[model samples]
Target: MRRVLAELALGVRLAFAGGRRGWLRTAMATLGVGIGAAGLLLAASVPTMLDGRQARTDARYDSPGGVTVPAGRTTILAGPDGQSGDNAIRARLLWPEAPGAPLPPGVPAFPGDHQMYVSPALRAALDGPDGDTLRRQMPYEIVGTIAPAGLSGPHEYAYYAGYQRATALVEQQVAWRVDRFGYPSLDVEAGAGGTYVIVAVLVATLLLPVAIFIGAALRFGGDSRDRRLAAIRLIGADSRAVLRMAIGESLVPAGLGLLLGLLFYLLIRGQVERFWLFDVSVYSADVRPVPSLAVLAVAVILGLSAGVTLLGFRGVTVEPLGVLRQAPTWRGRLWWRLIAPAASLLLLYPVLLGRENVGEARTGIGAVLLIVALIPLLPYVVPVVARLLPDGTASWQLASQQLRRNPSSSTRAVSGIVVAVAGAIALQSLFGAAEVERSIPYDKADPAFLLQARDRTSTDAMKQRSARFEQVSGVRAGTVALYTIYQKDIIGLANLYIGDCRSLSQLATLTGGCEPGDTFTAGSAEKVITIDKGEINPAPGVRLAVPAKARKATLIGSNAQGVASAVLMTTIPAQLARVEPGFVETRMFTDEKPAVVAGKLRGVAAEIDPLAMFTAMAPEGDRFGPLRVALNVGSTLILLMMAVGLLLDVAARLHERRRILGVLAAVGARDGTVIWSVLLQVIVPVAAGLSLAVGAGTGIGALLMRLSQVPVIFTAGTVLLPVAAGAGLVLITTVAVLLPAVRRVTRTEELRYE
Candidate 1:
């Protein structure tokens, strides 16, 4: 035990003993592992962050999804919260029943008379240069800011305004009496299936590659390291001692890198308020890493680093004279590499084909397996591609030969890039396929406008509502549909249908169109209700000059107004125009973008009808707006990460070969040949690897789409986009690493060890 400890301590001393090269390897390992650590930590924090945000929100409301309380001294009248659609302001009116009524969290006291309390984000917006429009809408006296405890995030927009007439608002049904705020805490998933899958797969995509690179970094300066180990072997230490020393060397950097990553994650949390994505913001305190996941991440990174370093010494013999490395052979390792992908497909086939309920987490597991499975295929793939390259020149022969070797070091270094790109393509395909399923073919256009109201029997108010509806943008015209009752039946216009020639024509067909104030009896109204064809008294003190003979017009097949039966009176007689309506509707015929128009009209209608039953006759499927945004951002970030990892891996490999290239140059080899050889070494293998990546990604996406019960939406663009991106990555990595590789190869000192 003591001897083993002595050797381990000796390895640590030797890690930093070899000047700049040793320290550079350590630094690179730290950075590589650090990146992976940070990614894992951030992914782990997502669930916790969302829960904390929900908790804060629930705590602030006193009762989440509110309940009405009995009017009492300690009760407050509150309600009618604003929606997120317009300016995202959560505007609410609060009227305290007594001075001792409990207040919301984060609020020290109620605002002064005629004053409103706003969130910090809201205050900032209102005070900014472009707050004029909002100010006009909310022209209340601003007394102070609502503290953080009352908000979901720093960017949330909310305001609590004092209402003087709480009783009147309660009576109007706009506000309700509540003894307290908020409800019990609800534990929410960061996102349900789509969201969770997106986040998880994205995190895995980025992290797996980083893990590969960390292993590569840990084994860097290999030639220098072997020579040092050879010296130890000469001094009577056995292979076990050498291996322990190697583990020690790798452990220090692995440990440091993981620790650095944890520190970086904490720093990110400290400034969490400054960050926002997918239209979401979180508080600093809410961003916390799950301890179990964090620990696992550290363990994984450290284990991988040490393991890869240990593997580097495989099949090498250290003698007293020099270190003898057995030739790197990967000739017959194909079968094992195929097992992972085969298993991955098996796991997913049940879900996609049989429609089995294996659960979302299991599918996520399948996706992750499929994404990294390509790494195992790299060795088999590279040789096949290299054989296709023309070996007409010295550089071509050299590159082709290097690829044919498929040394373990080369394989590990390139694995990160391959996995990253494969994962990206898979993610894109999944989204596109899901999109095809979500956005079904356009349904037959159902009416977008249908407003309902109750016992609103005032002619002037109904007319005014119609006029306001016309004011809504895109509304071509507006008309009032008065649904009168007969025999207490609540079906469509049972008693009367009165409108002018132009307005009533939209509801039903009229032969040659009649004059203004026309009247018609159709549906049940025709059979039961009787109308005199003269000046008749429909109600006391309300007399209408009825038509001598009413025309029976045909109701239109379908319309924006979702009514089964209509009076089809294209024109109401001019004399009966003043008849009051029993129940009213300001129906709208809006242009394209009916949703926007409908939303604006809803706000407008709220002035007259506190509870507006705004319903779209036909439902519109979700467009995956947030999913698209997340994919765009995630793709961009992962691509950048892929590029960096590829660059570093290629860099380390180049540095490892500096001695050989320097010796070749010393023997009169041309610099151009060396540079081209290195470039070809990467390009040819990557070209083949990327093709496999695309195939694998598409397959994974197809399975996910099937599991989601959506049609596969494969397009030329989906396949071609990842190809273009891979091509670009190769181009960028080539430009980034070439000059330095050439400089190192031509350096006189690079051949010192040789």
Candidate 2:
């Protein structure tokens, strides 16, 4: 025990002495580590938090142990007397009576056999049936009125459990698989099958910080313990003992880091809890943190890091004679042997991203690729980039030569910067692409107008207004069907978009081949069905078999096909055959060749300010917007931390090599020469990194746009903004490092260098 304590004391002395000698460097490294660690922890924790909250909400309604409802729970309701018309609607729950206060006197009752309870919101719109008459006809009484807890938009229902529960009950209480949000969880294998996508996002994002921290430790502390290990071994100290000391040193800091992380987590826990987008109070209040999971996760990270780091101390046949000389470079066949397999695994990303089922695989593969790519690639790339800079002033030239001489230093300086920049780029691109994809497809539109109506009664007024608007000069118009998912019925929420099908081809790129005026022929008998490329189950070119006697139409796919859980696209006449005619819709999507819309009509219908919308729809909890913003803010803060690290790296380098710069100044080297050298070495590598980041961001952005259900429009601003921002950051950070060095040089510090 005394020996162990002595060894530990020695480790502490070594750490503190090293830390003081390289305070700026140590701080730089620690800050890099902290930023990476914090970002990863925050990102990972948020998703877990969101998922747990969402899951808890969903668990309230679902069966335990993952049991699911049997198939065939979904059904369509035909109108009375088997009338083959728009009245043959699809509904899930037709409860006994409308849920609310008694109906007004002299109101007409529903004439049909008592079925289906109507929501108070919907029932209020019904101009009939006193509550007593409706109850007498059916036999159920309203215990209380229930509605969606808090939906984001007026037309949207954030809470979907009511519909799912109603459907399950109406279908004889079938045991449907409930999600955390109380919705019937779809078995979508790849796409968002559950409501808590925030968890997946959080978990995946954690990898960036983890990778950054590991890479920083490896690069910054490459030879941190070599001299100590050498000194100990010279005194006949056991290699294992030296290894233990080194591991202890790193573990000490790591433990502090994790504790700090946990503290940070707890500090923000209240803030995080407030952003529950759903009724997550159930999980939030009973905050029974799985102690085991936290312990396990921290232990695993530390163990893996320490194990890998300790491996550097192996093969130490330290001779007393050589203890005074520079330690030999480390060579381990383990890491070298593992490189090929690691690279191969990284290559799986493109394949995984393109796969039909990619939900879990993409995230897992993404984490692996990010971590592996950073560590092995950084050391080799940094020096090469440093050497590649254009020749200019001597300071610039010297800095380049210095970095080239010691590629390890270059690697340390650039690793954190790369991670921070890459993450920022990736996130910005992702969000930007999502925004663009969700926008309306067509760029050319003139005098386009949006008209929203409540219920089927306002159809004539809407149609007449649309006609009047279209008849005005220079207006070529059409309507887009606002098909929202009706969750009550188990059948895919098929919001039938009924409009002039011909103009769709003009509005957007069709996934399957479709041309304008194809579906809008004047009194034509041709049957055409257009499906989007992404539609599952009934894919394009595949024949759909409906309850027979109805003719199957030829598939004519389109890209502008809006969001539909299940889509059956035909002409307006055919659409009316399936749903209610009173719900018929038409929108004049005008080309407006001579003139565009009078105002900023781009994405007018779809432009959702996530923050404002979340509040407007679900004002009960503060979770939704805050949670999302926290993730983004945490990501941004990580980048800022990297910037600070870069500044520290530069400051440390200036101090460490202050004599070299002083000597250069004494030899008549101008301050410009010194400044240029630092800038050239620092700025060029960052620029190169930014170039790679942009290329990656663009390709990934495009892929995400393709995969996303929304219509993303990537403008020059999206591409150039991040790039410009990255370049500016590099420039500012580079200047900050050089200015202080120049000041020292001007003050005759070089004349005193021993």
Candidate 3:
């Protein structure tokens, strides 16, 4: 034990204070390990982020369920959820049944009628420049901020306004009576499963690349390290001593890397709070790394570093004179390379067999296995590509010769890129395929939109609002329509549409040229509506009597607002002179960007009616907006990180070859030839790796979709994105990073230093 510790301690000292060469090795190893550790650390925080947010939200669950708790002195009534601009407002107007009622989570006491408790995010929004609209909508003074214990996330917009009366709220049926704030934990609704699946795919996409890159990072400068070990052997050190020293050196940097990863994750977490991806954002506090996974991540990184170092010495013997490299016999074995492809097929058998209702776990497993399968085969593939290259210029031959002589580092450096591109592509394919399952009723990009007031408001008020919307830019046309219950000397209820002749014509087929006060009834009205006399009440201050001579019209079509109904009554202002019609719907067609138009409309509505909501009226549109957002955002980030690794790895490989480059310049090779030679050296392997990744990614993605019971969509954008990105990285590295090193190595000073 002492002998081993002494050797390990010696290596640690040498790594820290072991001259420039030792520092380079440490940098290479530390950077590679740290990047991977950071990815896994971030992935590990997912459960904490989700579960913690869910738990806090659950604690304050006040929605009225199937069973209502009878109101008492300890009970409170809460409700009237609405929105201000784009921010969703959980409007909680609490009316305590008696004094000293049990307060909601995070509230210290019951607020006065004019005061309310707002979440931190809501408070910030209220204080911002855009708060004018929100302030008018809520019309309450802020008394306190909701504590973190009562909120779902840091950026959630919510408020608890105090009201003295529960009478109005209860009658409206929007308010729920509850004696307590929280209920028992229940399973997440099925609607949330898509988000979970997206998360699982994202993790799988990142982990495989991270794992491959870490291995590549470890092998960045393996050649120099092996020679150093041989030199240590020449100094009377036994093989066991050398092995322990190597492990110690690898371990020290790997450990420092863990600290560096933690630092990186913390810095990133802070920046993430400033922005949201696909409506998904987390507070720095909520994103705590799971303790068990954090520990496991640390262990895996350290273990892999030591394990890779140990493997580096497996087939090679270090002698006093020099190191004898005994290459592995399986390096050229076609049989071994085929195993990866075969394994991938086995993992995807269920999907390939056209099985239905395959689990999400299988989709995730296939994505991982597909990317990982390419790694082992990369070593075998690179050499074959080199030998098969067409004979061309001297630079080509030189690049090929180098690849044939030493393909290990080239293979390792390209592995990360291969796995990352492939995995992201596969994940995207799953997204495309699974997207079919969402029952998007309308076109997502359609400019047609509608605004419906949650509360009952007059048709005149709705027409004024619609006319105001027309004045706003991008709104080509605006039509106001109302859907209400039509009852007159009737025992039962029937659907009714009240609109002008021009607006009513768009919804149903009329018998004659429509005019104001012209009442028409649909063919279905006689069957569903009864003729018996009964007292009917529709809206306050509004009474209706069906016209004595109503014409029959055919129901032709429906508008964006779904206004096609059994009874069509074009009532002029004179018939219901005092009626303030509730249930008003307005449709708008926009010529500008729908989102921008929607936001403007929201601002417009806040001033007119606070309870109004602007919803896109696309019948064939994207219903799962959030799921697609989180998926694409996560996939984009993972690919970018992988590209960074490739840049550093290639730069290191070029810098390490400065000696050989200097020799070529000393002999008579031009700068162009030397640069091109180095370019080919990296590009050959990179091109081959990228080709394999694209093929595997596409195949895996199709398989993933099949397994998940979704249509297989082969999108060119998703497949080619990684390829273009990888190719761009190589060119950028060659022109920017590698070109400088190549020029510097061409000088005589580079030769003199060695």
Candidate 4:
């Protein structure tokens, strides 16, 4: 144990010595690990934070198990449909007989009868300065406020009234049904299946590039450390001692980085809480990692750093001579690069082509595999591409030779670039797919004006409004359809539309032909009417006889709507036909703007909904706006990370190549030649990786769209933008990182080193 302690002490001393001598390198390495650790901690905290919020919400809604029903059942409020009315408030009555579960923190207990508690947002809306303008159906006394968690969405306006009044209201109304019965023990689990899978994929996509960046950073200063460790082995240290020393060296930076990461998380936790997850902001206290999880994360990061350090020594022998003689000539098996991608394609084709029954999990796995396949090909392809570069100048030749000599290192430097390019392509393809607009093809012209009433108005009143609308200039035709909510003896919730056959035919295409005087009934049920009206049986299709010049016609409900649905159209007199209280839709075909036509009819109608009309209209595609924005932001960030990685790698390489460059300077090589060589060294591999990434990314994106059953539409902009941006970034970054290094190496002082 004492011997182990001595060795550990020596290792720590060596680490401190290295840090003191090369503080900049140590700082850069520590910064990279710290950023990665912070990112991982933040990523891991998302699920935890969201889960905590969900639990709190469930506790608020379900803790006091009660019988809950809509407030409309007990009250005869105007426009009780909960839509398009000033009095339309979505209130729930909860009767808490016995406490089932404990209420969530910050939520008060249920209020007494006639006393109500409203959501905070609702309270703001009702008690705001303009609250008086918004009329309520009933004046209920507000006693308390419900926290945001008590409601489903931030914008939801809801009221929770006492149980006794709620029961009495339901009994009196005899219309509204109880929506939910919450028990104390009932756990309301959020819906999960495809949504969770998509979330997992999104999270994975976000972290993969960061992971690659961090791994590449860990390899920083690796060549220098290997040589130093080899000297220690020559002085009688065994392989175990060498391994222990390497682990200790890595852990020093990793431990400090972990602590720094934790501090970063603490600093940013408040900002994180301000952001919404699952449509609600989580409590600040809930957005923290549990003690055990925090410990585990630190342990894992430390262990990973140790493991990576160990892997760097994979092929290196402990013997000093063997390590010193090692060179970059060892090449990976080039042929093996093809296997992973080919196998992934083989597995993916069946699913993409629909030959296999696959779920979201399989599709996500296939996508992951496709992206992973591109990584292995980099080392093999980069060198081959370098060999193909035209040998225009001595600098180009030198750059190409350098790339061919150290393809693995070059590949690692540009791996993030490849991944970022691929992600951009995939995201753009998804955007194109989602932008496809779906519509039912209609051969007839659309109605120029469709004016819907606030509530069910009389047929006489609708006729008067339609007549007034038609009187306006450029109004060639107009018609009114009175719609009612009719409970069919068997069919439930049927929207009954009553209108003249001739006028209705002009507005919409009828399945059964309609003439000026013909009265016809068309619907799903076979029998138009049944004798036992009290018995609720499924409505069957009915073929009603056409009444010659009939004054009235009544048709039962149908399963289909629009042109296909069973509608009763007749020459019914406005005064005789029953006009149930519902929406009165006035359709008009006119050259005037809908707003103008609406203005003309407003005098005859009780209300007019706002309408702003423009002269010309262009159809826009149904683009995935939010997804596009997210992808654009995410891909741009990843690309930026890749740019930084390129810069770091170039800086590291410049240090490694200084002595060789100094020798070249001593030989009288031109400064311009060396500058070009430096640029080519960075740009050549990047160009190759990017080209391959575009092709592979496009293919993977197409396959993913196929797997998701979404159509792939390749636009020129989507293809060109990523390519141009990637190339531009490469050129800019290469010049930025290597220009000064090239100038420094070409200096006379550098030559003196040789």
RMSD of 2: 12.4
lDDT of 2 at 391: 69
Alpha-carbon TM-score of each model against the true structure: 0.76, 0.59, 0.78, 0.73
- In order, what lDDT does every prediction score? 0.65, 0.43, 0.66, 0.57
Task: In model 4, state the lDDT of residue 595.
Answer: 36
Best-first order by TM-score = 3, 1, 4, 2
Q: Residue-wise lDDT of candidate 1 within 1-754, one digit each (tens)?
A: 9999988898888778667766776887788778778877887888888888777788865443445567675444444423322234566667678868868777778775457888887788778874653454355799888888888888888888776655675664555766676756454435434454555566666677776767667766665577577667767778898888887877788788878898888887788887554446788888787889778877777778766765656533424343434244556478898888887777777666766656677677777878778887876878876776566888989888877875454455556666767766767777676555432222333245666654434445545667777876667444554533332344443345554555566566676557755666444334334332222223232223434466666665344244434454434434345544443655566665553454455566556553444444322223345555656665666566556656666776677678778887888889898888888887776777787778877876676566545566778777778778867886678668887668766776887863
* Candidate 2 residue lDDT tens string, 105-155: 112232233234333432342224432222221233333323322211111
Model 4 agreement with the true structure over 115-175: per-residue lDDT tens digits: 7777665677667764543323224578888776665444445666554533443443322
The whole-model C-alpha lDDT of candidate 4 against the native structure comes to: 0.57
Better of 2 and 3 by TM-score: 3
- The candidate 4 region of ten consecutive residues with least summed lDDT is 611-620
By descending lDDT, how would the candidates be arranged? 3, 1, 4, 2
Evaluated at residue 259, the lDDT of candidate 3 is 83
List the pairs of residues colliding in candidate 3.
441-619, 441-620, 442-618, 442-619, 442-620, 442-621, 443-620, 443-621, 444-621, 457-582
Q: Candidate 3 on 1-754: residue-level lDDT in tens?
A: 9988999998788565436645765775676677778877987898988887777778888754657666675455655435544356677778788665667888888888868999888899888986775576677889999987877766678888886665465655545677777876555534332334445555656666667666666665566666667678767787888888888767777888888888888887887666554334577787788999989988889888888887776533434353423232234667876776776677667767876555656655655666667887777778789898798998888888778877776666667667767766777666665554432214432335666664444446545666787887867543444544555444433456667676566556788778878888864455333222222354323345567677877654244233333677675445343433345666666655454455556566656654455565532233334545655575466556555655666666666667677888889889989888878887888788888888887877776565444567787877887688767765675577766666787775667653
Specify the highest-lDDT model's number.
3
Q: Poorest 10 consecutive residues of model 3 by lDDT?
A: 527-536
What is the lDDT for 470 in model 1? 80
Error of 2 at 174 (Å): 19
Better-scoring candidate (TM-score), 3 or 4: 3
